[model samples]
Target: MFVPGTASRPPAGMMIPYTEQLIFTIATQIPFVIFFGMGIRNLISRGDPKALLFGIGGCLASAYEPIVDVMGFCYFPREGNWVAFEAFGRPIPIFVPATYGWYVGGMGYWFWTVLQNPKTTQQEFQLLWLRAFIINLVLEYPPIYLGIYIYYGYQPLEIGGFPLWFPAVHAASPMVAATVINLIAPHLKGVKNLVIIPASVMAYGMANAGFGAPVWLALSVDRGYHVSYPAAAITALMIYTGVWIMSLQLLPTQPLKINGMNGNGKSKGLRG
Candidate 1:
């Protein structure tokens, strides 16, 4: 469905063929689904550090959204009043375009959370942002060149030229959001694995699907931008943020070793 904003069609050349896009979609989501399921299992088994990581990563993913929502640049097509939106009165609607940036950002956030464990203190939280930026750079450039994805706002000094700053914008903003979450994680209270896993997973899955778009359109009319696209991107960010913090909270609580006694059945670790 079209939202209440300007009905700018996605860049013509940027649109992948439906069949190919579908294949890519399935390919992309399958691994995430598997990993998230594994994360759920780990969370159920009392504690899994990676599961916690996913949870926290999912949560922090939404950090950049409020600004994007406010900017009127976001919109969608609507049959009714074109100016009215549903996303809680925002100007645009939730759609695929809105979502693409943050989905990738969540992955970047996840990498940083795992690489820099606060327990070790080897790297400060700031370094995590740096690492996330670098890794995203390494990952996104090749894909763009290979036509795996195309960026919309990447205009260079010349018209249609490669924008030097585009990748940096994509990588740095989310990393900054993640860094904020990392800084605040310790101060937040009542963190637990149980809270982390399910919430993070649900948020990511739903949001990535542009969960808010239909609802937003249904509610008001003119809400956000690209009804389905932006919805997916924001969802990814929200999920990442949730999962990232969840990981932080659960990491320290995991047991180093649950030792059972030898054949003697004497106290070995936990049994002892």
Candidate 2:
């Protein structure tokens, strides 16, 4: 339900220097370079190829970026930037997908690494979410500061031109993918790792669109619906947060290390 004239378009005549745009685009790939490098090293030495597969998958997953931006009321600039692809009257920048691949793919790889630890605790998982949230805030801030994009509309909990709601969902998507991949990666021995390429993309969509359905629906219905955008935002935030926390609690528990007891201290599992 894309309502015409509802998107918050960047102001006309707004343009970033092409040099600056190029610089930003290259800078965003630093993490991808590092992560992809690590993935290669891991593949050669440890035979673990999840990271590499995820990086490639993340690059492909950028297709979802334009779709979500339309629903989320975001408008990426096309005036003086490298346009990756256009959709629904919006021209997304190349840097947008670059960040998605590096940020989501890289972070998802890292998060899955942590979840791989047999000694991981529930607290550690929550910490991963917090860290991703903060990193997302930092990554997104630079583009907005450079006038490369804008989040327009009754965006809930916006600060410094970026909305808080964006980071919450942005950060959670990688975790969702990482968690799902962790459950199945081990059984995929040898060439089996390649299968996760498409699966990771599926997880990416589920994490963003599925978990974010509440807010997406809210934004779509905000035009004439009696419900206020902020109220709908608040409700959606609670639901997203609630489901993530529940996932943490309900997932299988690790062999916790309490008071220096190491993995021997099994304690009461995650569900309890």
Candidate 3:
């Protein structure tokens, strides 16, 4: 996506040293840096333990993203020549750094804060999630629709032996990761975790389809695959509606801690 206008074709992917890659990768993934930075700021301003946890979550998510990319484990095209991990006899994906940063700096940390404070009955958290989801859609939609990444000659992951949705379904990786983190974080309930799974899936699926990334490339870039806009459209709608419904059902139950005993001098799980 960062190719300069004058450069019609990409250079042969090469592996720079980790130190060099670190500098460039950080520079390129600005959105991710900002996201993590915001998490830190929230931690200091609000002094919410959850905010700090979210910052840590961002770092962890950022770390894993590159591994997924490097191993070609999840999906999407890589940008540079393969870098191999010495212990593992395989090459790493080129887009690992940027994609990982995108996850942590953008959504991972934010999702952590929300999950830890799910008891928030106020509209702020709800509205924030909605806004974040929308921004993600807006930023991601066009690359797939226009086949912009494909035109750059990167080979994305294939589904059913065909190129999956443009920009690739793996774009939902962070959403999936954050949801998993939420399930394990303190104060979460078994039931809420179960409910969040499908809801998140729906949200990501709808977002991918609705904004852009039609079932097939509209311009016949991959003519082998048949276009079925109806199927994609319907799936997206179902996912969006499903996520919305579940979110409503999972009402917040915040302020989970109790400070002391009840009138009977017995332990009570009630907020002071």
Candidate 4:
């Protein structure tokens, strides 16, 4: 249970009662179950399974958590009431992977659908990342504070007791994953659609490594320094890079219009 490179904080007073931690677990778990059901509904009723497969892949993507955690200086308490898996010394909670499935996979799939609309513009795509940033910041703050997971070292844009830089960079990951999946979507049909599952893991792995590398560079340097400014520049560049990558995907084809009308004023609807 003892992790070698684990964060040094978590003062003795930091460990709350397991009973209280269970509340956090169930709270996150309920929504994850709901998301799982939604994925199934999409598959059965809507005749689409990308979301479900990606959700499963997101769960598998959880396997990469410990590596990222250890390298990126993220920490999860080992004393948790539920431990799904442990690697490189860190013990991640069961809710962690559950959230990954819904938040990472579900949201990524949603982005994929949004991008499917040839009408969705580069500017709108950037706005989506902004929305993602706000959603992640708010959603992460509470659990990051109460759930007892944290980024331990030199964070660039630390805010509300949580590092803003991490979320900022993380927001674009779904976009990156979505963009990559859309490339192969046309060829995906029948059993081939199952490719989405591995694609989810592959996309997630590349996205995290690529988008997260900047802050990782700064964090790896500072360790316990906990300063900003210079680190902030790296953070901005990283976010901009994510936006640029997303915007580039929209370049080959131009978007139609704000209203669903293209050229001749014909009504057009978005497809996932």
* TM-score for candidate 1: 0.40
Better of 2 and 3 by TM-score: 2
lDDT (10s digit) by residue, model 2, range 1-272: 24465543446677666877887889987877788899899889998788888888887788888788887777766678688788777777777666777788888888887877877777777778789889998888887887777877666677899877778877777787787787687688878888767877887787777656666666666553344355556655664575466357436756667765558554444443
Candidate 3 — which residues are off by over 4 angstroms? Answer: 1-27, 34-95, 102-106, 115-134, 137-148, 151-180, 187-227, 252-272
| lDDT by residue for model 1 (133-231), tens | 465465445434444344332122212322223333344444433444454555434454234334343443343233233323322333333443344
Task: Report the lDDT tens digits of candidate 3 across residue range 1-272.
Answer: 22222222324442334454455445546765665566568658865334334334433343333332222222233433344221232334344444444453345446545645747443443354455545545554443343223223222334333333333333343344455555555544444334333333343334444433444233224222243444345445544453444345347444443456554555666555
Estimate the TM-score of every prediction: 0.40, 0.82, 0.41, 0.82
Q: What TM-score would you give candidate 2 relative to the actual structure?
A: 0.82
The true-versus-predicted C-alpha distance at residue 170 of model 1, in Å, is 3.4
Candidate 3 matches the true fold with a TM-score of 0.41
Global lDDT for candidate 1? 0.40
**Candidate 3 clashing pairs, residues 3+ apart or interchain:** 13-81, 14-81, 32-105, 70-92, 70-93, 119-253, 119-254
Comparison by TM-score, 1 against 2, better one: 2
* lDDT of candidates 1 onward, in order: 0.40, 0.74, 0.41, 0.74
Candidate 4: count the clashes.
0
RMSD of each: 13.8, 6.4, 11.7, 7.4
Instruction: List, in order, the clash count of every candidate structure.
Output: 70, 0, 7, 0
